[model samples]
Target: MTATRVCALSELEQDSAIRVEVEGVAMAVVLDSAGEVHAIGDVCTHGDISLAEGFVDGDTLECWAHGSAFSLRTGQPLNLPAYEPVPVFAVTIDGDDVLIDPAVKKAV
Candidate 1:
């Protein structure tokens, strides 16, 4: 599937995450301090919590409910209780637009 426009670059804040759904797939769109954009599955693997509502520390998004920090680059949880990794989607920056394909998982 073609990558669909999720949000504008201007809509994203540095070192934060926003929840967005593309083609029924929910993802957390994040803009790190380095200015790179990342897209990962919004649902936390262990407890089915929303990872977008969690904390952003460097390249990891920590699950607030259980303190499981998942890497934004690989989507693997760094701590206990979340052994499964979330899906990391390939992100595309076209001008000021941030695009992501729900069907495409980045090879980490």
Candidate 2:
């Protein structure tokens, strides 16, 4: 599997997320309160808008389109308006760099 470099670990803040595009796929890289990294498709399942534009709190990514929240860890739709789960990538921290595996499939 090829791992694409996303950003530096220091670039991500705790409980915050960032947007990045890899291989023509928009992705949201999130850092939870516990300092764990997660990668999910930037698009919301229910809408064409990007999930990176939404608000992220704790482990849930709140879609700004219709307030559908999805789990960052499992890519499960936690609320209504988004019955489908977004694609999730695998995240790896190498030294100070953040890498993501786009080949990883998202969970529902």
Candidate 3:
């Protein structure tokens, strides 16, 4: 599938995550402290909580419900409870637009 425009790059605050859905797939779009953009499955692997509502530390998104920190580059949880890795999608930045294809996952 083609990449879908989720939101503007300017809409994302640095070091924060925002929830976005594309074709029924929930995802978390994160702008890291380094000014890099990342897209990962929104649901925490440990629970039904949204990762977008979690904390951003460097390149990881930590689940607010359980404190499992997931790597923004690979979606791997760095702590217990969440042993499974969320799907990481490819992100494309065009001008001010942030595009993501739910069908395209970044190979870790």
Candidate 4:
């Protein structure tokens, strides 16, 4: 797996998501309600918009384009318009830096 340092842990807010690029893959960095950092694919399954450009509430990340909400832990879509799952990558916090494994795919 290819791991890349995206950003610092302090840069993210709780219950919000940020759009980033890991290598060539578009990725999303989410901070849940518990303030844990999660990495997932940024694209929406039903649309071409990036998921990071959306909003986050609790553990769910909602796409601003069409209101497709996805679980941060499982990457499962919770709402309509998106039946297929989006890919979610694994994220690790190394001290202060946010490290991500882009190869792992999950529905986010």
Pick the TM-score winner: 3
Whole-model lDDT values for every prediction: 0.94, 0.87, 0.97, 0.84
Candidate 4 regions exceeding 4 Å error are 105-108
Q: Which is the better candidate, 2 or 4, if ranked by lDDT?
A: 2
Candidate 3 weakest ten by summed lDDT: 99-108
List, residue by residue over 73-100, the lDDT tens digit for candidate 1: 9998899999999999999999999999
Clashing pairs in 1: none
Model 3: C-alpha RMSD to truth? Answer: 0.5
Stretches off by above 4 angstroms in model 1 are none
Show model 3 residue runs off by greater than 4 Å: none
Arranged by lDDT with the best first, the candidates are 3, 1, 2, 4
Q: Compared with the true structure, what per-residue lDDT tens digits does model 4 show for residues 13-67?
A: 8888888987789888998888788887788888998999899888878999999
Which ten contiguous residues of candidate 1 have the minimum total lDDT?
Answer: 48-57
For model 1, what is the error of residue 8's alpha carbon versus the real structure, in angstroms, after optimal superposition? Answer: 0.3
Report the number of clashing residue pairs per model.
0, 2, 0, 2
TM-score of each: 0.97, 0.92, 0.98, 0.91
Better of 1 and 3 by TM-score: 3
All candidates: CA RMSD in angstroms?
A: 0.6, 1.7, 0.5, 1.9
